[model samples]
Target: MEEKVYIQLKKKITVEHNHLIKLDHIAFVTGNVPYLEQVKNIKIYQITEQDKNVSVIDGFHLLDTLMVSYPKLAFDLIGPNQVIIEVKKQERKANIFIILFIWLLLCVGSAMAIMNFHYDVSMQEVHQSLSLYLTGRETEKPLWIQIPYSIGLGVGMILFFNHIFKKRFNEEPSPLEVEMFNYQQDLDQYLIHHENVLLKNKND
Candidate 1:
């Protein structure tokens, strides 16, 4: 009778979860009979009359462990190992001042363009009408100076508000995401190991 053999190959596993969940553990059945012996520090077991199964025992815990111990290796194995990481979306606080400032700038810029195109009137006249009582002969600043100063102030305000907006909104990922990604990576490696074993058996 032909000898029966089972080969061990790596398997691939994938994990999925919302931003709120984290990976815990994964388990799977193997075609090979559980080995009751250890060889060269490895757990060796026969899968069939002619084939065997060997766990890369030393490396099982080394999956996502790369992120902390070996970041480069972690990145390399992430995609190929069939790991899936999903980060939960976090609700960030909105900056009211930033929103208002942006709206004001947009309105002012649009008004300036519209006024320049349609009014056909001097800026001095517009200022006088807008500040009739304030611009009475008591004012020391000339209309030319006031106009440029106002424009400069508006530009400065816009730049300042934009800086604040970026500071508030460009937040880093929460700790949960990092943990979940690492957990998923580990699951992927285990699956990959099992898949490799199955393939090896087919070829043999």
Candidate 2:
């Protein structure tokens, strides 16, 4: 009886440049087959300097290559039909000056946005009117009401984001985080589709 060789192809694999793309790097190849080590180390492709940063490898192509060398072995392949090999981009070290600059910019921008909104809606006049009704006095500035409202507005923002600096107030993801996660998922799917189309067009 032919020995069973299980192969679980990965959906996506990220790696560095200038490396031999091996079966072991892309999939999980297992089962007590003789020359299993050889099967796992099969040189499926190479990420050369000349090659593009992204490449797609189909499972069918991999299977055909394996059968040529080990026709006697039984293969059980699982997972997605194609695998994406992408070169991981190196990230630059964080600079404190850049971070501080961004922080200041955002702070100034946010304050200006809030002030514009308040001005548009005549918030100060509304507050003055409400203060006159409650305190039975015509006041130019409602510091008691405005101070609490300003503090509450800042607190509300923190609560909405569910984060304060690097610390998270809750386990649930914030709205911004959820949006970013969705964007990443969409990007991955697009990469798969785009790469597959390129391969098909090349074959044609």
Candidate 3:
């Protein structure tokens, strides 16, 4: 009969810069730096090289940087860390007037597009007819109905985009937020795929 030995190493590690943590029954490693275990369950690791690097975003870095072997359990760990990132202050010079001009142009262009589309479809005539039917009176401009409809447009836009006022409606995501999240996911996947392709090409 053979004796069974079970050793379970942590598959995840959370660490901070220049902080010591208990890595008991687990061996932690990162950035090709050999991490030494102090005492029984104590481990110390330091973070260096702080500049805006794509590999490290904000103050967090994810690394599959741990390996431990005892008897039965031996695997790698996906270690993530929030470390001190020292960013060099680079003074950025920008033309604020130019940026404002472009923004104004965009707004004007969008308004023009919408107005042109509505005019092409004679939406004003539809509005006039709808207003006449609602008010049961022949008028040049339907100020009563049109005013409320205009107000409703703004309110509807706010509700559609934000879902609520002050507080949210449970866990349900707003239409805009959902669209933004989906866009972010697609962008991430696209960037990852392109990065892999670029790496493959470089290797080739």
Candidate 4:
């Protein structure tokens, strides 16, 4: 037999400015069942029932409450897990692109250096032959200036492409979507606990 589940809101309050303020709230769905039969059932029930008074307006409410109650904590519980996941994914892709860009710059720079060296040698040979036939000398550019110039040009091009890619592809999650994602996770966990409790009760 399929049993019905109930949704409940739990609220926790803390004293702020000498007045009681709702610290955090969690919305959980659970079925009425005996606590002893199911392991962790009591704890889940206590977590939900204890916070029943605080209204959960959005997923971030839980994290906001935690942040408000615990000032020293660094992580924001209000943000959706999906947002964190997406941001991490975006960063990974950006890093990969950055690495590829660097590799391409190195390959192109190496090819250009080889070509320039060959061209310089060819020009030198022509100049030597011409100078031998005439009463003139050949002028050569310094290697130090040429090498730095080529490197600077390659670096500048890579930077420009990186900037363009960031502008075109980089995206951050919106506040609402993050909240929704968090809410969904909480709701699912709550329902699962409730179902398990009901199932245990039915078996008993």
Give me the candidate number with maximum lDDT: 2
Q: Which 10 consecutive positions of candidate 3 have the poorest summed lDDT? A: 53-62
**lDDT agreement of model 4 with the native:** 0.41
lDDT for residue 116 in candidate 4, whole number 0-100: 94
Query: Which should have the higher lDDT, number 3 or number 4?
Result: 3
lDDT values, one for every candidate: 0.40, 0.84, 0.46, 0.41
- Candidate number that wins on TM-score, 2 or 3: 2
TM-scores of the candidates are 0.20, 0.80, 0.48, 0.18
Residue-level lDDT tens digits of model 3 in 81-151? 22222233345677899899999999899679868987899877888898788878787876776678767
Q: After superposition, how far is residue 141 of candidate 3 from its true place, in Å?
A: 1.6
Candidate 2 per-residue C-alpha lDDT over 1-204 given as tens digits, one digit per residue, 9 for 90 to 100: 658999998988898987788899989888887778888888877776655677777777778778887888888888787788887667778899999999999999999999999999999999999999999999999999999999999999999999889999878889999999999878877777776522553487
Candidates 3 and 4 compared by TM-score, better number? 3
Residue 74 CA displacement from its true place in model 3, Å: 5.4
For candidate 2, the per-residue lDDT at 70 reads 81
Error of 1 at 40 (Å): 35
Better of 1 and 2 by lDDT: 2
